[model samples]
Target: MRHNKWWLLVLALVLGLVLTACSGASDSTEDDNAGENESAEEKVLRISSPSDIPTMDPILAEDNVSIQYTDTVYEGLYRLAPEGEIVSGIAKKDETEVSEDGLTYTFHLREDAKWENGDPVTAQDFVYGWQRAINPDNKSFYANYLMSGKIKNAAEIYAGDLEPSELGVSAPDDYTFVVELEKPVPYFESYAAFPTFLPMNKEFIEEQGDDFALKPENMLSNGPFKMTEWNAEAGWKLEKNETYWDAENVALDGINVKVIKEPDTALSNYEVGELDRVTLYGSQVNDNQTSPEYNSLAETSVFWMKFNQESKTASKYMQNENFRKALAKAFNKQAYIDVVYGNDSTPVNYFVPKGFVKHPETEEDFQQGSDVLAYDVEAAQELWATAKQELGFEEVTLTFLSGDSDVAKSISEFMKGELESNLEGLTIEPNNVPWSQQLEIMRNKEYELAVSGWGPDYKDAISFVDLWVTGGENNDIAYSNKEYDALVNAAKGELATKPVERFEAMQEAEKIALEDAAIAPIMQRKTSVLAKDYVKGMDSLNPFGNDYSFKYVDIVK
Candidate 1:
């Protein structure tokens, strides 16, 4: 899935605008005194983010909220550039040499890069990071995907039968790193850019213990910016690291990120010239789109309904295939897109959002097929009837759990009304919970039906299709298909050697999953950013979300 955190990204952009506005307004009062030092240049840039930095430890941080913050503070061997191309970061430039069987990889690292604390960044850092992640005791969900079968003995290591050192990653010296894989991976370089694979400073992690990521002092940054201040409730700030090897190329002096979840409050701050950028939603889009300040940008992300077939609390009704299909059929996607998103979004038919992947061979555009469980009252009623008869029930009630966002609430209400009115002998209950609680429920498979969205980890079709692959950690829906799983596994095995073949296999896997109605995909989300005309260099190479490079951003005098 793409690392597109729409809400969180919007919050960050809005907060950037807010901080700029606040400083601008305050600057007027100190203009006389500040004018003299104006020639000194800006040393900090302020940004806003909606979610808190969950963890500073890359191995433990999996969500986009944490990934976005970490991306600025940590440097990977390779980093994605603004043009969505991979560039050398810590490695300088790695040489890939495939083994005879095409299952082994050896990477040569740069010898000069050093950690923020002045310790040399050796290939051992990468080896240690990989070991820590796959260690069974750590139980990192991301580690399962990142290491998994890629490294020899990794699966066994994760199962606790083998020592962490037994994993396939090894640093022969200070600069040579070798990786052994159980199968060939085509997107391995892209995978290296992911947060889970970023190197960590062992000494710092050990010293800080559990509080390593709690404050700026406890952490050591390896990326363009270093953590300066992190007020749990207020926000976090990043100051440009002058010691960064690529510091000369970095534009912003610093960036401050605020956590603001409420759209109206964010918009109010933006309108009052307290924010440099803000994101508008549904009706707010209409209110702001016509405004002189509005600047909307679309991104590739999909928000949809996830059915927990393995739910312990509400499993009986949700596990029923007919019930799941009925719920999907009851939703009018176009109506939701029209009424909920308007011109700001487009309805999604497939689970993988459009613009996520390109054909490996032809490089042709792959559009989402019309295999959606489209809204049809009559069809929904028919499916519901069949489900009622099969279950030998007079009535069935199921709850839809979602985060407590205004948009989530509205969509839940819309779904409830649609299902209740269209399907007989069915009750649709809506449960609104905090995002943290909602994530817990989804992870534990505690909800019957839940509202959720996934952004790609890398720009690949496998990222999305892998969700339903049997026991995938991200498979909150408890969807399991042996054939689908086999196809995905096969694709993963052949990804490097047979790129076109792998894509075809994945396409077949997606078709099978969708035909089963494993999950209902709703709309493709567009990230709308309302920025003041003067903010420039907002674009960064980070594929995860909006990149805050305030170095090049300047307030027009």
Candidate 2:
């Protein structure tokens, strides 16, 4: 009896042990599958910007930051898709009609489209916005720019030769908007997607007057995101607009941006999982090239040193063509890029960036077979000698203007060193200022030499070549060439319908500008960025327009 009792106890203990082991295995399996059964978390993306957006008004917004922010908060007739395709915004794409000559476009706006204030978006808003842009009294910088040569009577309106009411855009009814073009523009859809072409409510704008777009409450959004918070010193926050027409398809809940000027600080935040995206430069790029998060993206932006040929500037030497050529060739572009950017950015001698646009018929890259302004040290010295003799001065000093950002400072310092070393008795004073101040100085032509850059507003060589045209709005350098202007104008006017000839004309225009040394070409920018692995659906880095479209971006784990 005692032996049987002991055997029973032993059997009980073994069963207990087996049950404990089985329970442990079950808990492990549940732990492994826990995430699958849990509810999804809210999708919010965090990003960093180097500086605050310059302005909120699309008509006056010239910088990329302002354009990017404005594009998200406002809707044009057309919008660029995530993959850079022209997509419908307020206007229904399939219902739109075009004249056989491609000179007129009639758009039917969607009835359901409403502004953030719950007012129905109408075709008259577009007419009013376009007319305001062309109104000479408004002094919009981009008025006669992209619109003048294309939109019928736009140039005349901007020049005060005609009334703004006669500017070619009309609203027949509440929903029908008609535009008359001066000529056939192949890239008209691309232009329509730009921020400058966005609609504005005349009543709302007039009510706000000078206070318009200065604060978040003063604005209304008609796009996928709405600005919920804006603090220039801190940054801005954008939340998904529940009132947006296509809000159901918009994936991101919100995007939080911070203005972090220091790359080190930005990277540290990224490492701690505080930031999902950040741009890196110089040594930061070199250190993280092997990381999975690293990405080197080629962009359409090209930076150059713009010489102020105005006689009032301190550097009187810039008026001489040989002096400009000498300054253009004095530096080693490759070395400067390597020392400052430390990425895949290539040294370029031409203003138009490579791989940006292609020939219409041959489909060859636009920069192909184009003349290269070769860097010849010997030639540069000879040009400097001639310039000095012509100016009757053995020594010259110039102020070099640039932004105060770390990357900008590095670039300016390198150029200053190179110029001082290469050219005898040449002194380059590096003057680093805030971005806004730099822009103001450039606009007033208040600097001797300034580092400036241009990114495409549309995917065409004309975007780059048109800047140096005689009396062009963007021609802040005071550089003008009649031949260059003729070529560029032909590309925009008479050759508008001829794709190949237009392309060639722009190419020839760029060559003329470079030969005259209107601006010293530097390296085309290739941005180095780091993004978290869980961040998804941001597939396209646009060569034109806004860099990112957050509508399709999703966070998945």
Candidate 3:
């Protein structure tokens, strides 16, 4: 069997080489005729964004679009390579010094790393960025992330007990940045690579004032690419930053991303060569499966249904444990994915997606033997009966908030059908709104139920599990459990030094949340893309943070 699989791989590689050669040969005539134009052969990657970028400020970025764009234009101490590997950004490679006790990390910034305006990328940029992100006045959505990393005084500063200047980050010199952690974090480097930790030029930021990062001209770039043009109604464009320290190795000359919401429109543009890559869903996937351009990836992002415990219209129903459990069990996730996605995405029963992390000691997958999200229509009906009796109600109606995108609408419609069909006397009215509006509604706890998802900011399970903690920044559901909080706190506290114990605590915490139906696990997403044959060097998909790094991407001629 092993020999056969190896032979298959060899055959695939040979076929790939043949296809590449054929593509290059077919484009030779056009390339020769366009020699005088010059721009025809420029290496540009054209892609599509499902929504508009919410913000360019790294500190305020919470949605995927904002975070991905911020990642491209900003650099921190480190950056993530393809497949989530840590790589140098402004920090010099192999030059970071660590204390023997693991409480401090000192990074030496590369002098050559400079912003687009020719300002040197210094350690103080990082110091200012970290301090600004956690400052109370900023109201950064990711402020809690710093506390989770155990950065010294982060909790105190966030709690108003200490000042942001005392947040344990300092620049002893122009090129040396020091960080003090309250406890050792094994994933500190990974956190540094996150968008929220990206550096900001204090001078440029202050000069821009209220307009900072709100437009293309207001931003500075030390990363491989710098934004040249941006329009909220249109799209954004990024060009290679010549001032980047490693600009010589950067492949693409520019990247153009269009704000396209519908897959059919994106597919039409891709077919006409206006776009290089487009994602497919539902019947589109099956139609393109035989095409050479077809590609798919099982992502780390997980989608779920969140019930607002403080909802004005449905608080009584949402507060009932039986009601929430009944709704969670009433839907058939596998059937919905099959009908709506028509891809390789799998239904999930846990918050932490499978294949993301494993048991530190046994090396076993973390999702083993969990069925809290099981679908059982009969059991769901029974629970609904009990809930109705407890609440003294016969019929209930709730608003289901969702994004206005075609895909989001499909998911909402299917879920509404499933829940209404299984649970008697229940009506789900889906209120589809724009992506930004949906986020605002959920954040303000104005929705009875919402369809939401999360991709890890780092590699740890804590990234997903910590969202349900009481008063957590992302805890829009208003679900709280003291025991669950203790488990999560322990995992981040006393268990910080014990790998196995920490993993166990996180696992227990997830189980408790699922059992309580704090959120209904829907599916582990699989991104399926169709790319032109000439595109190369993007095979390895990032399981976290931004999905793609165009730094190494190229147009193979």
lDDT of 3 by residue, 1-557 (tens): 00000000000010010000000000111111222433866887777766666578877766666666677788888887887788988897599998998899999988888989999988888999999989878987565544534899997787778899998999999999999999888668767777778788999999999999888889989999999888774677888999989999988888877776676877877787677777777788889999999888766667778899999889999999999999999999888777677788888888777898999999998887678668989989999999999999999998888777677788779888999999999999989887667767877899998867776767777777777889876778999999999999888778888999999999999999999999988877676778888888666556666656668789886
Candidate 2 at residue 108, lDDT? 95
What is candidate 2's local distance difference test score? 0.73
**Per-model TM-score versus the true fold:** 0.88, 0.90, 0.92
For model 1, what is the C-alpha lDDT against the true structure? Answer: 0.65
lDDT of 1 at 272: 62
Per residue, candidate 2 scores C-alpha lDDT tens digits across 194-300 of 77788998989999999988888888898899988888746777888888899998888777777666667777777766677777767888999999988887666
Query: Which residue pairs in model 2 clash with each other?
Result: none
User: What TM-score, to 2 decimals, does candidate 3 have?
Assistant: 0.92
Q: How many residue pairs clash in each candidate?
A: 25, 0, 0
